[model samples]
Target chain A: MPPETPQPQATVRDVTQILTRTRGLVDPVLRRAVQQLHPHIGEMAGFALGWRELDGTSRVGQNGKGLRPAIVLLAARASGARPEAAVDGAVAIELVHTFSLVHDDIMDGDERRRHRDTVWKAYGVGPAVLTGDTLLALAMDTLAQAGTPQAAAALRRLSSTLLELVRGQAEDVAFESRPWSCPDAVTVEEYQAMAAGKTGALLACAAAVGALLGGGSPSATAAMSRLGRHLGLAFQAVDDLLGIWGDPEVTGKPVFSDLRSGKKTLPIVAALASGGDGASRLASLLGARPDDVTLRRAAGLVRELGGLAYTRERAELHLHEALRLLEAPELERTAAGELAALARFVVDRAH
Target chain B: MPPETPQPQATVRDVTQILTRTRGLVDPVLRRAVQQLHPHIGEMAGFALGWRELDGTSRVGQNGKGLRPAIVLLAARASGARPEAAVDGAVAIELVHTFSLVHDDIMDGDERRRHRDTVWKAYGVGPAVLTGDTLLALAMDTLAQAGTPQAAAALRRLSSTLLELVRGQAEDVAFESRPWSCPDAVTVEEYQAMAAGKTGALLACAAAVGALLGGGSPSATAAMSRLGRHLGLAFQAVDDLLGIWGDPEVTGKPVFSDLRSGKKTLPIVAALASGGDGASRLASLLGARPDDVTLRRAAGLVRELGGLAYTRERAELHLHEALRLLEAPELERTAAGELAALARFVVDRAH
Candidate 1:
């Protein structure tokens, strides 16, 4: 039997309904993108379809929420940019994300993703590698067809964003082979740098491209970029929380998989720095081949050390900053409200 | 030991000497590109020095012979288009070729290139991959800054060429894993398709982009593209010949490396289809484990099966056709002769 999808919104208040509504607004744009991508991508049909076909049901369920693209649209709308002009840029970033995920799965030897066989596991390494490359090429291709003279600048933004993305992935991979005291004991500064490189760069790109293509004012684009960057930080913090504490049904991975893999998520970092006997024990147990029981024990130790509380506080601080940034400049009230609501949704929700 | 710097004009026969002479005219424009690319390229500092840091040999080399770029330049010049106007397009395609070589070496698991360790082997996979990606991005960046409005159209040519390169790689990888037999012999038709996808696509792109960027007539660009396609085919056939028969010291690879890898290069395919005892022996030897001795034996059998003779005839035929295409609609006499000279150089080289 298939695992149940997590309903993190059920126990959450206010933000649940806001997220759902915003998602509704974003759905049409995504549908049109997939539609356009499906037909006009004929020359690359074999390679393009090969990537799309690598999933069994992984792509069907528990795929990453379309958060980055939504951020692009919301930020674009807030900055008085049109939604249509921003959608392709949104699509391009999403494709980059998907491509990165495919390669990361291979590098990590990950077998399952989003509740199904990962691309590398299903299609073999060479094809999976090529699929990632094809997605990247197609991302450039889509950005080029951005329907305006401003498309060139938008593509430049996308290209720089990709360079940053590769840099982030390199850091992450390099970290994996190095020594670690505990799964979550990474320095806060290091954590922030990784988040900014891996997550914030693309989010900033999404907003910048959208605004550029939508004929937005330079100041407005800068404002949106600021908002997007903060949102990306908050989003990653929320994701790190889900990796450690969220239910397996919702996340579509074995609960505490990050601990098993020795990932140093935010909470663990805070807990490790606030050291005690438990911290020592946590350090020893990490990279020690944790089973389910060990993972539960580790979680208990993290909570006892105040890691959980510290992470939550940091996330809340960032969410507040994001909200403040969103309100700093001239924007349509409704668009600003939507962004504020999305920011709240990111922090408060479980998955 | 470092390889000696090959002189630009010394290596060229009659066919390519004129191309070497034109190099003097294009040096200033090419240098401008090298300057522009330097600021954006981070870790490619050694490469920027162009054989300087490697083994401390600062002597000038052929500067990649400028074959592909010159096609772009001369084709543009032949059609009443100024050489100055075609430089960026020329530089862009050459950059793209160098970038392709970097990535293809990684994909092919090659240890040595340009008489040195391949980028991935020398610098580690992450940096090498980034270098290739950076160069690809830089190509697009350079193309976008073209001094003409037709830059967009030229970029489409490069992007489309990239798609073809990926397709060819996919096909090559897939073909390698399939069962080996004369039944699986790639027909001349399939060979043409593969060559078109791999070699011909970029050559045609070089000529097409040059014409478009240089303000040549549409008919001229189309004719040049046709000529380039045939020239590329002839070039590959010669390369296949060298793969089997070239001196290892000159080629910088093991002699008959293609046979050991079971790469059904053109001559081998032609030999397998002839269906004689020698062909049978060659196929059986290939299907068995290939040591140095077995590969040498297989090479002898392939020769006896008329593979080398057939490939030579086929290459000469394509070279003749390229010359014919160059003469059609009558390009200016001097330019047409230069192109014919290039075709002969491409098909008749010993290495």
Candidate 2:
């Protein structure tokens, strides 16, 4: 049987309902903050946020899952503040999330996200770059203008997280130019560090910012950060799995997108490191510029080489650790339960 | 002959000496802050900052003039604080200025700056983008971690300036796509607005940040901001003139760069707005994708259309206003004299 939170199941907020509530609370603030940009930049930002079409017409489209925002509001509530007190934190983190997606699309030359054209795909690269810059600036402004020590603390953390994002991205780009199977190739340890910076930093900041804004004790903030880091690791592992095996219709990417791009994700790195017949074969498949059928075969080789199993194990391990933190007696049980649900949902999502 | 300040001329610091002194005070802090980044990211940042060669070899190269840092420290001193009190402000502003240069090079696909390949040319576009983001984050980190209310206020203002920079950049990009000679073309008023956002915002932020960090009264900060804005406009007008007429040897740019790139700068707009035979011929020159000879002719045409004299007059006009602000009773006399000297130096510099 799966482990469960200490709170009664009936008393727990369903993850969907929690996300719906968060979207309602965060979007108003988020949209208002985005509107503070130049009108043209705001339109681009709106398109990135799924609130507008490429032509600047209003549209209801697929948006982010709001997991980061949910983490913020839930962490704040668990720390004993009303969710409203941390709304700025939520909006700020969400803006950062969107900024990363917009910039990453350009960096990776990705054309589609959320089954729609990416910001760079719809707008030109320069406009997309400005949209990302606008969102990041707005994120900083939101926290800085709050005029409180808590906001300051949160801003400092957020700022550091921005560096981590760049650091991780720098590493990711560097990886592409390097060999895939030699000492010069990226290592498991190196990939972990990159993932920690790229995915974990913002998630850790999200929870910590929420707790700090909610007037939580330093210890409480640290606890939230630890849990968030584990959750981030879990999220990345799940994403690695989806990158290879996920449905294109669901993932909004080409089938075997990671394999096709020859991205040095966790599964590929683990497979390469495994050192066996399947590992050698997997490397050969990747070394060849893989087509769709070759990519599917490469996926099978990655699984046979134990890369998939090892990655899944890593994800579950992190997820369990994150869920275990919810048992801390200092947390509000209901909110903790919701966070656990959200974490599980993230790992289980199709995209 | 130039007007002189009320202070004895002998007491005014030489502009180069002020810049050299400021660089000494600010680079250590700036360098230490950048080194805190991931080694790879820091390496690219170091290159962008002119502290290293592309291959990560440390080489002293041409750096910025330290004008922004000088303003920051001078403003702090004028506000009755030790220059040391505002070193972080100086560093932060310098980092932001560097970030703008790195990103702008990539956006404009510029090849050279300061007699060297631009960051995007030295490193690839992706690394250049990451370098820009890293510098920006370091800037925020330097101020945010200061953990003082004064620092917080400075950070808040700096955050807004980031938006202004983007807004300015966005307008600059938009200007490229619009007509150059029609009613639909960029207007003089619009050019000023863009200049403020692009150039004036950071300068204003620099002085205000220094004032705030140095414990200057809010009114003093506002005064510094006003002076800084006027100085920024002067700086931009001088740059516009340089863009068209500046020697490649001094400017570290191709001669007639603005015209070659079809940049709708103030000089171009004002000349076209003059509504004369020369203006119409200038427009035709630009539309024809001018060669070396045509570019020279276009430059001559702009001068004949009164663009050159008008731009010079505008530069002098703003320079006078900025220098006049040094007469404020609240500022220390020696520092005020230095600021006036620096403001004059900026507009007069060949590059």
Candidate 3:
């Protein structure tokens, strides 16, 4: 990925408008995805999504940022592709992302998500698991409906990315049992590897699939993927910051929630490695089952130990790299500007 | 399907031999299925298959009947289609079956399968879970490589069947937890619906896919699927019998194993509904944990209650139905005869 490019602040607003408009355009496709299931499959997925238990279906419906599909559709559109040609591809990626989230919540034993009961907690594990499996099948089923070989190529990217996501999850789970310390002490390269697999893979897949559907040349698709990779890395670094230090109102999740779970986020690791007395205290509390007060204290300890500052710096570096990739000559200037703006928006957004 | 036209018994034996030869031909394809995974996916599946951790690759691979894939190939060959054309389709079905077994072992907390540690026990729950997921992905990936529209159709069958299997599993799990028995007694019809989803869906998918690849007419393919459905029902009934009464030496599983698990197998349900002292005795024992002695005694009680006779009659009925379906005018007689022989073998086998 390119590591040097003049930062363009003006394009940021342009990308935000594009994302907002594109999300509206994608709603019908999401509805079609949910509607296409065989009667039983649909009922089960609905139950798993807590359709009956929720106030309405609002909690499980298309309520998210829809960031991944937005990346997909915008990339397709920026390349002069007809939006109609690629909606299914975008929906396929979104379904895959949703599938991973539902299953991951179960594996992690997380009971609440999107401010409500998770699939497993709502419908029970059996139904939730089946629902996830159904969504995955739906994703594959979507590919057959892709109008060209481009669909095949997009699906290949999605599949490979899914494998990588699972591998990253395995590594994350494995790390929980291992003795590990602060974020700052570990090599930055290791952090990048984890982020790439866990976060960057899907983003790259999204962009590449969009490019493929948009009829971009192979090289252009490759460049778009790289741009997405850097953007994903930047996105994750910022997310790690909010996990510990952001306003709860803005992020929706409780502050320092990652710390309470003993997550090994970038900032926490960095702070452990870099801070003086605070680092020692952090190590002692690393895996402790902290109560709310203790968790808040732990977050303070991490910041005191320099986690926040170190994380912000890393996010900046990733952002600069993302911009460099977006500025490559192979991309059309307007599209490149929009993508670069998107990358900046990702790192700078509150939520 | 040709229940009326009883082909000579000798013709059935000849077809079994043909099936055995075809299995020999497809053995390499099975190997490819195991080997095609990234080293991790392969190793995890192997580990889940209960390869002893003591340096050797372990021995549980010998346990499966390989029934699903065998039927797929036989159906393909019966249509004058090259067995080679069905190899990938066959492998895909087997892997999917294996994936289900791994997850079901966890959900059921089944410690021993085929008299060895199940995947969850051998590899731990987390690894075993991922192993199932990996196998599922591999199944889809393998189907994608079929390089024909048939592959897409095969994937639809494979995935839709998976969804059905999960639904069956949910019902099974829910039944086990409920204070009352399944609201609908375990009647032949209920058992048929459960077994069709749990056992027959995959087999039906296998036959349908085989026919698709084997150049069979759509109607002929539909006939073969009906044959598979009947065969699968018969197979599950025979399996239920072995779980309770077969000699441990031949069955691999301990005698009356399903009774200990409180499984609502046909025999127990049929016996429970009977107004007999033996039915009451069996129900009392079922409510308590049964040791080997108790289990054996329970099996005797079920037999005395006529549960075993009832189960045998149902198996025979299904086997008869399957044979009739195979005898349908559209079917390839040679193939249908072989499938009929296979169904008979399933219902009559000691194990």
The candidate maximizing DockQ is 2
Residue A203 CA error for candidate 2 (Å)? Answer: 1.0
**Which residue runs does candidate 3 get wrong by more than 4 Å?**
A1-44, A47-62, A145-150, A181-188, A248-254, A268-342, B1-42, B50-57, B174-187, B215-217, B248-254, B268-307, B321-341
How well is each residue in A200-239 modelled by candidate 2, as lDDT tens digits?
Answer: 9889999999998999899999999998999999999999
Each model's number of backbone clashes?
Answer: 4, 0, 14
CAPRI grade, predicted model 1: incorrect
Q: Root-mean-square deviation of each candidate, in angstroms?
A: 6.9, 3.2, 6.0
DockQ of each: 0.22, 0.69, 0.24
Candidate 2 Cα errors over 4 Å, as ranges: A1-13, B1-13
Scored by lDDT, the top model is 2
Error of 3 at A189 (Å): 3.5
What value of lDDT does candidate 3 attain over all alpha carbons? Answer: 0.72
Query: For model 3, how does the per-residue alpha-carbon lDDT over B258-316 read when each residue is reduced to its tens digit?
Result: 88788888788777778556666777787777787888788888888888898888888
User: Local error of candidate 1 at A148, Å?
Assistant: 3.0
- TM-score (C-alpha) between model 3 and the true structure: 0.81
Where does candidate 1 chain A have its weakest 10-residue lDDT segment?
A38-47
lDDT (Cα atoms) of all candidates against the true structure: 0.69, 0.87, 0.72
Candidate 1, Cα interface RMSD:
5.0
